[model samples]
Target: MRRMLLTFCLLSLLPVTYAVACLWDSETLEQERNKFPGTLEVITGNFPRHSPAFYQWRLDDRLNKLANDPDNDRWLDDVAVSYEKLGRHSEAIEVAESQLQRNPDRYETLANLATFLIHDGQWEAGLRYIDRALEVNPDAHFGRERYQRLLVQYLLQNFPDGQVEYPLAAGDRIDFPTFLVNDQPPGEDGQPPKLSIEQRQAAVQGVVGMMRFSQHDHPVLLEVLGQLLTETYRPKVDAKQLAARCYLLLADSAASPATQAAYEQLAKKSLNLQATHKSGSEGQMGLRAVRRELSGELAAAKKRYNSIVLKEKRWIASGVDVEAAYRQYVNSVQW
Candidate 1:
């Protein structure tokens, strides 16, 4: 639930069939917007909806339980999560901090604290907590913490203020793979690559975990997942199809028409989807079908995600060591 609550998405000027290769300047964004027909509205209402009242009820219930059993400490996370869902990030952080102060070894509390901090735009602080959480249980969440660490580092390095200046693109072509070893063997010279096979494989696992557990709408996550799929060969996964879905979602969440257009162009150019369609309108029709398919897939994934959370709770009740159990589970299924 924490994973689902915190993840988010973003955009270019495209609709469904394009991809973006580089970041655009403000002037470029405006110029592209002018070239498009009608304005592309920022998409909303598609995600699984939860009412504010539902969160308020959950918060009240958790608070009541905490009042009854002040020493239990279990209710703290529930309260914090409810607060976060209600848009009270400061309160969430406060609750999580108190929980951490009480039991610093608790992995969920550590991760929740990091998430709340990130939600509040405290990227550096969030990174620190994420590091602590990783130390507590690096294998938790299917090793997804590593990717989060890397992502925060990238964001802090490129945009210290935690806001993207323009629509992100891969430039004339998608190129992050150049830095990674991917599926290939080590260089003949026997030198290590910047992103070795192990690292790339682990990062792909993290991205897959995020896609399965978190909301599918977050643009940064989508973009990174798309990039990883294109670069790293994941057995049995349709890289081009999945990457197209990621860009399609990007277009949906784009801030302006120009950004949406850029993503659409990227999808078509990068995925070679245009070669099949006779016209842009035909390509759009195909994209709509793909979008519907992706949405259905997301819904099923959400159900599986909820089941995992429940399974974790049950394991805790049965006195199971969750981190060790999760590590075993990751080992069993990991690529």
Candidate 2:
């Protein structure tokens, strides 16, 4: 009890609106959990379950207090967040919705409510909360992360082995990464990344495919498609010119010189990303495989080039620079 009190007081920085005010603490100095206000246990990532009793005691005490004046207190949202942390989905949603109705514009409440909704697989409502968070702050990482995941889920359910585009407030689609290997990749800071790896891959694939499916080409598609292909040919690969494939395709299909340049740049980034996979787990067998595969002659790449040509040109009826993609295509081809 003494240790937990000290820990709680220690973490409480200057109050910043709801973030700190939301936590519970002892009423008297040096006391803990006997007379606290809020129901949140606050088991943050760094603080593990070292004191389960302390948290439970606090929660129980707070629950009793709330039962007395449940209609007036705004602790429901905090309780919901705590329930979510404990994987108590049903209770979390109940509290989250209750809080949301009380104060519809309270973004924090809506965001917390949405989390439980997603956990409960109530996606349509979850997306509404996500949009609420975005409206509060388009860069809200937590909201965007949840929102992005829901979008993928919606797509998967609607289109098995198909894809859709999410209209993000920042933009319609992300600026695809060029092929390079950076240990800690940077993405939109406050935008939460989707959790499912397969879902993310599928979403990327859908966007890339849509760009190609368009007869009238989209210049932005090359960058987006390049990122998908880069991830597709993932780690521990040997000569997966999936990087070059993206480049070669973009190079052929690009409508103008400027667009072709963008393709070249995006493709180069892909190769660099692939390079990060080389020369780890150094064993004789692994080394042999790497040597055999990396050193092997790359078969002449025609399918990739042809796809790009057809893709970039079909859309550029309005005088696109066909030569730009053509020159880049010829340069990349190895007989």
Q: What's the number of clashes in each of the models?
A: 30, 12
- Candidate 1 segments exceeding 4 Å error: 1-53, 169-186, 189-201, 211-214, 232-238, 273-335
Best by lDDT: 1
The digit string of per-residue lDDT tens for model 1 on 93-199 reads 99988887789888999998887887788999999999999999988887787777777676665566677543343443223343334346766797544454456
Best-fitting candidate, measured by TM-score? 1
What TM value does model 2 have? Answer: 0.34
* Cα lDDT computed for each candidate against the true fold: 0.59, 0.43
lDDT of 2 at 311: 40
Could you tell me how far off, in angstroms, the CA of residue 47 lies in candidate 2 after the best superposition? 7.9
Q: TM-scores across all candidates?
A: 0.62, 0.34
RMSD, one per candidate, in order: 15.2, 27.2
